[model samples]
Target: MRVALGVSYNGQSYDGWQSQPSGRTVQDQLEKALGKFADQRISTLCAGRTDAGVHGLMQVVHFDTSAERAPYAWVRGTNSFLPRDIAVQWAHVVPDEFHCRASALSRRYAYSLLESPVRPSVDAGRVGWVFQPLDLAAMQAAATRLLGEHDFTSFRASACQALSPVKNLLRIEISRRGAYWRFEFEANAFLHHMIRNIMGCLIVIGQGKQAPEWIDEVLAARSRDAAAPTFSPDGLYFLGPRYDARWGLPDRTPAYDWLP
Candidate 1:
């Protein structure tokens, strides 16, 4: 049987999502827990991979296992062996044809920022920080140029392994509440550091360092050198993949409520 699970993790302490030989990644920890619970080796494939210092709200994964257990049993059993920072939110018995990555219609991500003069203390390693007051209108104008499909080479990391730079950006919603700013993005797929790279440009533009038209120019250039540096991964979150309703999977977890 194949099982699909919704996972959430604080990526601050781990290397990243992929299992590493160092055995210090979210995947490594989760797989270890699963193995312990089932008393058999287990492996998983995820819908998306988040960078270090990044967080995940509803990262989906699937694994093939001969261990037969109730859905809730899998959830409670696996989580029992996991650490405090990583958790298996929910689980379901999925069809053999269901793949967490390929079955997704779209992926969503959120970036949280603190726009205050003081550096974060309690929320350290949880949000990106900008001391300058942002010009919301200018940033919104700049974001309009990125609404549709385009070759996002300018904003992609050089180490990105994605075959192509072209990606359909379904939406970009920026909003603010007090000293906190939230940027939500939906896309067919994302290149490595795509959102962080774009956030770098947007931050500069919002700070009045550049004009809104610069985003268009950068997109047209399709050169990595034309864009701003990649921003911090602290604030980035893999909001999760959107699957067809027929799958009957939950879109979000409790972690979503805690984020801005």
Candidate 2:
């Protein structure tokens, strides 16, 4: 049987979503816990691979397992062996044709930023920090240039293995509340470090270091060197993927409410 799981984790402790020889990645820990629960080795494929220090509010993953157990059993059992920072939020039996990654229509991500003169203390690993005040209008204007389909090579990372540099960015919402800033992004797919690179540019524009139209110049350049440096991943969160309703997968986990 094929099973789908909605997992949530505080990524501060793990290297990333993928497995590594160091055995300190989210995937490695998850698989190990699953193996202990199922009494056999199991593998998983996630909807998206988050980078180091990137949290996940609802990370979907699917794996084929012969172990016949109730959905709740899988959740509780696997989580019993996992660390406190990671937990399997929900589980459901899925059709063999359902692929966690391939079935996603679009992926969503959010970055929480703290705007303050002093560095973050309470939420140090949970948010990015910017000492200088930011202009909301300026950042929004700069973000507008990134909407729609375009070659995002300027924002793509050098080690990105994506087949193409073109991606359709569906939305970019920037909102501020008190000293907190939230930037949300939805896209058909993302290249490695794409959002972080864009965040660097937007923050620059927000601080008056560059004009809003500079985003256009960076896009036209199609060179990574033309864009600003990649921002910190501390605030990045994988909001999960959008799948067809026919799949009957849960759109979100309860952890969504906990995010700022």
- Candidate 1 per-residue C-alpha lDDT over 158-216 given as tens digits, one digit per residue, 9 for 90 to 100: 89999999999999999998899999999999999999999999999999999999999
Look at candidate 2 and tell me the lDDT of residue 132.
Answer: 97
Looking at model 2, residue 36 earns an lDDT score of 96
Can you write out model 2's per-residue Cα lDDT over 1-260, one digit (the tens) per residue?
Answer: 99999999999999999999999999999999999999999999999999999999999999999999999999999999999999999999999999999999999999999999999999999999999999999999999889999999999999999999999999999998899999999999999999999999999999999999999999999999999999999999999999999999999887666676
Cα lDDT for residue 157, candidate 1: 92
- lDDT against true structure, model 1: 0.95
Query: What are the per-model C-alpha RMSD values against the true structure?
Result: 0.7, 0.7
Q: Count the backbone clashes (under 3 Å) in each candidate.
A: 0, 0
The global C-alpha lDDT for each of the candidates, from Candidate 1 onward, is 0.95, 0.96
Query: Could you tell me the TM-score of candidate 2?
Result: 0.99
Please, what is the TM-score per model? 0.99, 0.99
Q: Which stretches in model 2 have alpha-carbon errors above 4 Å? A: none
